[model samples]
Target: MTAPTPRAILEYGLSSGNVGLVQLLGLCPLLAVSNNAVNALGLGLATVLALTATNTAVAGIRRLTRRDVRIPAFILVIAAVVTSIELAMRAWLPALHAVLGLFIPLIVTNCALMGRAEAFASRHDPARAALDGFATGLGFLWVLLALGAVRELAGEGSLFAGAGHLLGLPGLELVAAGYPGFVPAVLPIGAFLALAGLVALRQGWRLRRAGAGA
Candidate 1:
């Protein structure tokens, strides 16, 4: 494969090698916390923070770690970072943090974070690692936002419900008017169904665009 440029790296993170698309990692939290925009944004930001910190730290210490034990060491760094973020969330954003629940700690297990650390961060400079982390994290964030928007609109007939709390604007519950909510759209199974449909739609669009270009 050709060497990845900075722009290419960013593009890959925003789309192609996205945790949901290329790596297919962290689906559990992706589906679980994506019930609303606020929840999705919170989880997405946490994940980005975890990935960036872990990747940067790993890259900085790459020469110090033995190859055989690198994976464990990486996990240790990730766990510590995730735990720190989890504590911060619990202490400050208790309500939003509660909505995320176990998934916050679960960021440690998210293969996306580890995958980037092992695959990219281990071999790259700190600057490159930071870029990779931001790109990959942003990619994951985009998907979570899309999924959350779909779920929230369909499930609750709203968007960004309870967003003001996160922004420190207390007592704001933004609800759309005259909306018909579909309860199943917010459920676990609904996440799978929606994701599958989106995949299908994306495929169809790709095929149609290819045909037109041809």
Candidate 2:
């Protein structure tokens, strides 16, 4: 198959081919940590970094690896990259890292990482692979942001609370004072409910577009 164009990359990886909506990768952390905007963006940024670095490294070393051992090689590369990301988070974003916990290291197992490696980066050049990685991560990030924001507003009556701790940007947390949040939204069931609503909304939009086209 031919490599996707830059615009196509963005459209698919960020919008049409959204990891949450379409590909449905990395749901473990998605449902667990998306209680607020801060956690979502923090993990999203980390995943973005992992994806970009993993893609670039995989593409850079593709020519040297044997075809038969490619899968293992990719795994090892991804592990190393994810570890590096984890350490950086621990050092600079300790609070966010603690909140995220095991999920940080679990990035190595995210199918999105491996999928991009074998499907795109292995065949494409580094620059294109990097672009694809960023786009893909952006897609995932957008979902995380939406989910986190919605849950925070509904569950805790606040927005972006504790957000700055991740990026060290003050004033990121916004509190909706005097609002009594829905408790269910902060629980595991709440993640499912919120995710279901999001998926439904996306499908509704697609259906509307189809009807318009028809």
Candidate 3:
């Protein structure tokens, strides 16, 4: 919550929104869409857009919005941005939109967005709020991309398969034959396992960093 310097904000977003690290605030989409790279990337991008827009809006209106009603105001801002994004995705990326389904609209409820708006955006200037939102979104996107790649590779024996459907490219899909498919990697349980491993790795890195600093 203490997002000050640009570097600090970046680190905060990266560590907190790691999806596998300390702040697992937004898991619904993370777990659901992470089964494939395209879906993960799509959702991640949407979240980034939402967070950035909402944060900026909230920051700009902080003085106008009263404290008691700020949360609702923030949600409304986020919902508007998310709705616009959802519509655009549905029109242009219909296949990906359908796959994301209800979760696409549900980005309104993502705590990470609201949390940043209320805690960071409301107090910070527009510039800082935007930076924080983008940094945080990048963090979330990083996790999604990594998880998606891992699951897609392990479960489908291919990487970025059917990417053309999302990218509008005819030959974007690629395949690898060597991966003996593991069905579990694409399952919900697999998400948990993969996230756990990622969390452990992050914690270990932090410990090493702390020791070196000491």
lDDT of model 3 at residue 210?
A: 95
Q: Which regions in candidate 1 have their CA more than 4 angstroms from the true location?
A: 1-3, 166-173, 212-214
Q: Tens digits of per-residue lDDT for model 1 on 127-161?
A: 88989998899889988888889999889988888
Q: TM-score ranking from best to worst?
A: 2, 3, 1
Candidate 3 lDDT over 1-214, as tens digits, reads 4548988888888874443256887888888889988888889999988888888999999999998999888888998999999999989999989888998899898888888998889999999999999988888888988889999888988777877876676575678867678999999998998888888888899899999999
Candidates ranked, most accurate by lDDT first: 2, 1, 3
Question: TM-score, each model?
Answer: 0.92, 0.96, 0.93
Output the number of the lDDT-best candidate.
2
Q: Cα deviation in Å at residue 107, candidate 2?
A: 0.8
RMSD in Å for model 1? 2.0
The clash numbers for all candidates, in the given order, read: 0, 1, 0
The regions of model 3 sitting more than 4 angstroms off are 1-3, 16-20, 170-172
